[model samples]
Target: MKAILLHGVTAFLLSFSALGQMQSFSLQEVKVTGGAFKNAQDVDLRYILSLNPDKLLAPYLIDAGLPLKAERYGNWESSGLDGHIGGHYLSALAMMYASTGNAELKKRLDYMIDQLAQCQAKNGNGYVGGIPQGKVFWERIYKGDIDGSSFGLNNTWVPLYNIHKLFAGLRDSYEFGGNQQAKQVLIGLGDWFAELIRPLSDDQIQQILRTEHGGMNEAFADLYILTKNQKYLETAQRISHRAILNPLVQKQDKLTGLHANTQIPKVIGFEKIAMLTENAKWSEAARYFWQNVSQTRTVAFGGNSVREHFNPTNDFSSMLKSNQGPETCNSFNMLRLSKALFLDKNDPSYLDFYERTLYNHILSSQHPQKGGFVYFTPIRPNHYRVYSQPETSMWCCVGSGLENHTKYSELIYSHSANDLFVNLFIPSTLHWKEKSIQLTQATEFPYKNQSEFVLKLAKSQAFTLNIRYPKWADDVEVMVNGKLYPTSAQPSNYIGIRRKWKTGDKLSVRFTTSTHLEYLPDGSNWAAFVHGPIVLAAKTSTADLVGLFADDSRMGHETKGKLYPIDKAYMLIGDTDTYISKVKSVGNLKFSLDSLTLQPFYEVHDARYQMYFQTFTQNEFDAQKAKQRQQETEALAMEARTVDKVSCGEQQPEVDHSYKGEKSDAGYDDDGRFWRNTRSYMSYQLQNKGFAGKTLEISFSGNLKTEEVGFFLNDRAAEIIAVKDRVISVKTDNTELITLKIVSENGRPTPRFHQIRLMK
Candidate 1:
């Protein structure tokens, strides 16, 4: 293979095994012909075009000390996570241009690259970012004046994570859009970043890594591949968080309390670096993580985590109850990781997960008609999702959502040296330029159980065509030219057929799908209906969708609708053995369960829906109903009484409440609870919006040494009312904004605090 030149440097050569594995077609090499995915692609294109690049460029321009063309977007863009969507937009425009050959997307991508190049020129040190006070922040890091938390570093919101998006965007623009200018900008930015962290010790770098830095290792690894600079590769290794990597390398599951999206990207980086370096230990660790997360933590729809953090694998009650369900960004990153793993290992199993998540989570995350993106897909009964409006919302999910639908053609077809793999059955046309092969796949998959492939070739050529036999498919049949092709292939593997393929030749595949009940991974009583790779959900109601279309509010992406009682949700009653039999087929990939209609979850939108249903035998129904009612009553009462609350140790909750600390630590306990404690001091700003709060409740995991802990509210000493059942109650005034501080007195450590609530 010839070494390509990038920014005056030769490209690094990959391992023979990594290079020879399943090779994915570029988005430009395949096109979505027609289907729901095509509609989604169209919608995503409109959403991409709806945004003004200048507005998205404002932050970068401001950081560059240049004139702004338009105002910065609100929500996340105007907030601390500025220019993040701009980076995602670059990627979206590049991939969308590749997928659809849309001229407008290409134009916008070129314009953005040009603008970014100008900004890079102005910065002069190869640094161009929209991070709030970008220069000063880098200067602080350069001087080793770093203070880091889970979601913040130096009192900024994920600046490292924020900038990694730009890194990825520039990489994608060059890789997909073939923009040389993006390549130069990326190299310049990479050089600046490398220098920025050069002076810091590994310990200081790890401290910075404690914050949510999105795939920094992956970015540097890609940089190494582009420039073949060992320094870039070393930087990648240096930044890979040892706390996370060491546990994974030892085949440990220390990921329970970690932020789901944060770790997923790091693992993606791990896999990438492992593949490039042929590091067996890192590769094994990456695979172990994939197996653990995919099998244990992921929901039926292939999304993982609850409220942005991984809950205990054995208990999913919090996931089933919280309005903050599996986030779209998690699935988005998971898919990227899955794609990388599949390409590296040529594993057919990864394709199974990729297909499942693509259909259920990523495909379902967009508004089909109105052209918007969903942040969270709640499993909470009667809960809905909020979609992003282009001019109003700029959340991380909106950024990932833009790129999700634009690249449905990515994994449709892949190839090795002499073989072609039909990975997914999405309706698309693949142009294999090297071999002069044009194969068009036509299917209404998950709707119609059959797919047909027609090949248009320049001449008769022999190559093995590998068709994936999905695990959920049964009695799969493949035909060539209207004749049955005899083959023996087990599920979760591929059936390869090698023959001379000429123009006008046809290949057909058919499979059977069955409706079945899939319980949650925790072995809980709750289950979801699945038809093949598609998850089925029932629309519960249309009422109380308060933020259906998100506004510019910080938490607007969350569905603030009323959460119905868990006992009141539709449940599967009677024998578990008869549950699948009771699901009478009513339509394509649709069924009737009791009085409710279940359709493909991607099709069930614009209303409140239930993906998981509680299962109860007739004998246990009444008792379980009473238990759930009592639990719900107590929980709802607390939520009703509380003016504001924060779950300590969790990223979003702490960041949302403006949690700050000195000499602090947090982790998930063996009892499946999160706690944070400080040896010095910890503080959080909570909003008592209604002035109805009379008392403050601090829940601790274990007994607190009250003598060693000092509590203050609004900069004044707080009066402790009572300490019972591990909860400390304190008297509070009618302060709208309460700044509660917990200080460790006399150099003594504070107790592990789980939650803080302002109550009536």
Candidate 2:
């Protein structure tokens, strides 16, 4: 490995300087080839260009309404109207246009820029956003109106983050799309931000920093690079989140349970700042963060998190309990971070994480039908995916949903100043214009264990073709022109084959599969099952219980359980550990299931499924098998008559008191889900609704603590209290009765109901 010489701004400056000063040096250029199944940039641009930008942008434009023209934060009802997000779209558009010379995309960007310019002009200042309530929001923050005791701010930095996206878009337009008006608009926007913050005290500034803000510093650093302006660089440094960067720079591991994507963009800014300033400490810090996250925290699916927040390392057993795990947007951001590290160090380990995530998380996010996306990939076995709706559910998945399918061409191939690196084996063709070479890689990897690449040459040229030998491939064989060459000396590293290539040169690569158990880092004796690059999940019956239609409300709430404990009713095999009689091979592919019949989750789509089963040791395995047989015999003997219900010994408590307790001490029965305890003080059990209905009325014969009564039904809040005196009454009209829970305030415990009725 060669030593990295460039540091800080010097590194960026030197790239340009070297191109200008040295006769041998030239501008390092990149472009996508217009061929079938090429690099991500190519495939991504193709998909993006195909979309009607007007259709996508129309909703936002209308949503922004007058606030877009007024240059103010609009009503809280419309969040997408904020300028920052519009900027991101423009940036993505500009990049797509640069990658492919699409005139329609350029036209859409121009219209957006013109509208934003009008908004800025109307404000009589450089301020541009859809937030009409900006003044009121800031006032509330200054008045110390803290909500939920979490932070002291209104709407946080969401508006700012959105604006940053616009700034980035303008920057990309100028640098990549050759749009000068975009640059002018961005400069005006930057000036507005500088003036806005200049009046605030350091304490006020710190208070504002508590909210989640994107990479504002990185955008400024990019501005400095483009214009060679010192002020821009200074602003970039100032915008760096000291709270996040300070801890990371000190090599501290305080990232447990933190929002993954929220902190990643800040590190990207740190990386940019380090590149511009030539700060070795910053560079080391950025690298350390990337390495730690990529290596220790990731899952077999190449993603991290259990509920949109990072969990403790190796403790993924609890991942399946919630549907909100490993959000796709987080994976998208992680891949971007991976590309940055790979470009800097060209480490094979980075590629490993990239491939794993791309296959398991990113590819899986794309819906097979509508091209919509999933918000999270639940790691719980037997669970199906919950996809985002086209217009209704425009959450974080919406942003990533747009980017995910468009950029499959970007990661297929990368090049340094001289060498070509083929990192992924997606079906794609690469055209290296400078080298006069075209390389096409063809394979359906994980589905098939082999891939082949053919090189087409306008003329013979000398270059190194580096092929990645994936970490999962126990043995890899590389053949050129039907002759097998000795394997590369390093495992889990790229094999650099330097040769003079001409037209029709061929390379065939083969990867062998091997099953491995990955033990959890925690002291728990559990492990995740993996075969080759694919993660295997146990298949169970969740599909039949829920309808698979488009209108099915059960899609998102399908399988409700943790990953470890197998539900006895749903378990097809009596014991998960000893259930598999054999691991069989169908040609080159090998599969293992309970009773020799399990399949991968991706393969069992549209069917009820489960993955990740318990593995048992030899002693426990044989014992469980014998016990299962005995239970099977007993089940046969009991088949003569139906045993509908079983009863346990009942307990009776003696009550001697004749006096009645004060009715004022009892809380209101909101849905008849709560009642007074005759034996002791108040106590409550949250009730699960057995059926679906609309109206719920609770009647109680007692003086009620009206203010104390509250109900939470299906996680939606409802407050029902007695309006008058002794008789308490409450009612509500709702169709679904999932779970109804009631509680009291002022430390008074709620009571269990004696009689509960559901109204249709």
Candidate 3:
């Protein structure tokens, strides 16, 4: 929800050059005094406090030339993505300190910075990282011995993306926590990073950018601002991927089938560089990307993608079919993009999207009490989410989740040269020491439609007050001192009130709230109910919420519970308006349906729930019921007859199934289906315990080079006599474990493999 044209790009670009020269009221000027956000922040702070700082610091200490006082946590920490969460913790703690001035958080931030500083000092060359054997890895990469992929570089798990976390963390520590030592350490690390690629040509860096180097561009831009170094600025521009940004700037939507989270953060850096360099074309490109994603790509709850990739814009059936729904990290980055766009354009649409996403997605991602973080919020009917325990889970979502709640107070209030803009109604206080004004806002928000703002000043002053008019509200009312003020302000814009204001001046505004039906972005019949900005959902059942609290498994983020048939789930019978009208609010944020109670998604926890439901008219419902029942029967029969299956080329499945390969590559087709093939060979180890199946079935496309594929099972040659309907069914003897491999003749490539399963 950044900018929707409150001002043109020309005006913004013209003033952008001066942006680097001027500074706003320091971020320390505002603090979260009270409200839902403050409570959530407090909960996050408690969760962070429960984690042993020494254990979290183990990786940095190990990398920095210090002794580890604790063992590394399991799951991703013990896995390849080690040291990532430590970076996120530094950022979250620093942000929490700035937002609330919690002394404990400050101590934690200072401790982490000090530990990392020790690591940097010992490295002696401004090099500080916790990627296991990072010295050797980067040295190899520095010498141009690179083997990179989407998630790996030189056979290591995204060390660049991993280290970017620390770069951003150190920057946040210095910027937010005011650690002077962090600034020096941060610059040192940036210098090390810059010089690491300074020897390589832009072509080599572009090739390196193909890997998911999370926000290296944004981090470099921040460094440029910090030291005013031209080299860092050039490095930021060079780090950007032209493949993604070029099409976007030309308004070409080349984002289909691309990794959604990987690209959004890159576009955010594009916007930042646009503002810093006064390049309006890049700014326009970012705006287009935001609009494309927000309007077309996003779902009802303000989330986007399925299986962590952007599904086709013309089709979202994949979204409903998969247990892995919209990722929390995607929304977190989208909010960042929205905030950046909002700052330059003064657009209300940006804040509107921000409020919707913040409440419905970001706020809903955290476990309110048990202190865990949710990775994927599945929309599939009767499917549940898995929560990450602090000691076990180290997912990317967990890292972003730690920072999400701490950032609620970031946009509550912003200002101009003379005017004060109240962007959000979150109950917080903004102290403008330079202007001698202190504004305090208090509201129950989505539950209560009115918010009160109190103005306190040392003396009388003249300035304008711009309050946002949300699109969800109707007949927005503005009152000064309990009296109706005469002003006509349209929804989805800022309503300004300018006058000489004295101390203790009270301003109140009320927004009329109502419920509406939001459909899937593809214009499908499936829809979710929304009461104002909050997405309202019903708890369908709690049966079989497997892994509600996750184990320390690699695939713990996925909801592995049984997907109660979509056809059997709650069906909103009636027309769209009828469904909306029938939604009855029981009390507070809960709504009553026939067999379930609908509540805000953030409030519905630890249960199986339905956010989107199938809607149909009377005749359509009856007809679809019979057709859907048949499809369900066939689908279930197929599932019941299968032993174990692996989705080829998908990240989680490949790794979980022990995928091993040489000279192999993975990619998606135009229809967003992933496939993997190898020039040398590739294989997967799957389960076949107590199996009666005698056939191993492998699916492939008709368009691939399949004739020369040599099949092997348990290292024994298996004859694939002929292909039947694009599937090669190899007769096999049943065993406890099945090892399947596909090899090619000479150096030729194998066919694109889609799925491998054991079938009766």
Per-model clash counts, in order, read 0, 39, 3
What is the TM-score of each predicted model, taking all chains together?
Answer: 0.95, 0.70, 0.93
lDDT scores in order: 0.88, 0.55, 0.81
Higher-TM-score candidate among 1 and 2? 1
The parts of candidate 2 lying over 4 Å away from their true place are 1-88, 91-107, 135-152, 155-157, 171-180, 201-203, 520-526, 542-566, 569-581, 587-592, 595-608, 618-760
Q: Of the candidates numbered 1 and 2, which has the greater lDDT value?
A: 1
In model 3, what are the clashing residue pairs, if there are any? Answer: 1-350, 2-342, 2-350
Query: Rank by lDDT, descending?
Result: 1, 3, 2
Which number leads on lDDT?
1
Candidates ranked, most accurate by TM-score first = 1, 3, 2
Please list all clashing residue pairs in model 1, or write none if there are none: none
lDDT of 2 by residue, 400-503 (tens): 55556545666677776666767777776777777777887778776677788899989887776777778888888877777776643345577666677789
